[model samples]
Target: MKCLIKECDSYDKNQQWDIVCDNLWKLPLSQSVLMIGVLLGNLFFGSFSDRYGRKALFNFAPIICFTSSFLTSFAPNIYVFTILTAITAACIVGMSQASFIIGRIEFIGNKYRVLCVNLQEIVYSLGTVIPGIGSMADIQRTDQ
Candidate 1:
């Protein structure tokens, strides 16, 4: 959302009415598609990971994610970028979550399983914080 907001602001400042309108109209649709993709990918991959093994999936997902993200960064237009972004979100982020949860559960003893699950919440919070810190840097840079 922050990135979209930044792009919109850039277009608005430049008086690029067509680009601005296109971006504004498409934001909701793009978000909806991404949400659906995430949900569906999660459901499909979660079961597949259970049947197969975590190590292979875990290692492979990051490669797909990184490649998709790298390609997205260089996308020629918004449509291509959005499609790549959705693919990254679905294959990379969605699959990673499923694999991580399954792998985390399998590794720990039954007694410590609950604690481990709770610990993941803390780790995820930390993950959010790292990006929040980067976003603050982005804010500062934009202010300049």
Candidate 2:
């Protein structure tokens, strides 16, 4: 079992992984994996969607995203968690933002397309920010 944190005191039962930060060194690595995945997804999926149609990627990526996300929660170790996180991040970008926005734009009238995209951006921004706010709030962790 690979462990990301050398000094973490808490263990997650589902993922069988460590929790809480004793040092910040490994945190950036985790974030970097997600960003790299997103970059790869954007680069690859953009061309893929263009060639195969956005609808197919839009329809398929979410199923992959959801499955990877579900599996991430139950990952047996840090390595699996990292791999799954990358997959989840890739799928989120490929399915939610790129394919979805393009697909929605194609179906809307010219005059309404900008408005539709702006609305989608607003919703997506809120969805991203709200959870971050919740996470930032103080919450005590308990041991069983």
Candidate 3:
């Protein structure tokens, strides 16, 4: 369990992560866990929201997203990071697809609901791209 390879500016072995996630094999599993969490999120939060009301669920999405995202960043080990990542991924669905969609569609008239959904897609597309752009910029900055 030794990384005899030399370290670089982007990755210093002494500072890099250890204890449960020191290799690439677990990355795909972590990703799968995150994706699978969406199903669990929908199942759990969907019904919970039904009991509590979609508006309330939507309102909590920001807090859940922020808390999970923040905590995930601070995870000291791979297992903790993976679990928090799944929670964050789950909350992404709970916040947007399940809860907000339910709330917004309910608020809109049936006739205009289609338009609302379409607009939501536009926003979602932007959301997906903006992060990629930010990541690209970050890489470029780091390379500089």
The list of candidate 1 runs beyond 4 A from truth reads 1-18, 119-144
Better of 2 and 3 by TM-score: 3
- As a TM-score, model 2 comes out at 0.60
RMSD values for the candidates in order, in angstroms, are 8.6, 8.2, 7.1
- Candidate 2 minimal-lDDT segment of 10 residues: 14-23
Highest TM-score, which number?
A: 3
TM-score of 3: 0.62
Clashes of 3: 0
- Model 3 scores a C-alpha lDDT of 0.76
Q: lDDT: which is higher, 1 or 2? A: 2
Against the reference, the lDDT scores of all candidates come to 0.70, 0.77, 0.76
Distance from true location, Cα of 87 in model 2, Å: 0.6
lDDT of 1 by residue, 19-138 (tens): 454457666666776777677668766666677766666766778778988998777665676677777788865676765676787788899999998998899999989988887784
Best-to-worst order by TM-score is 3, 1, 2
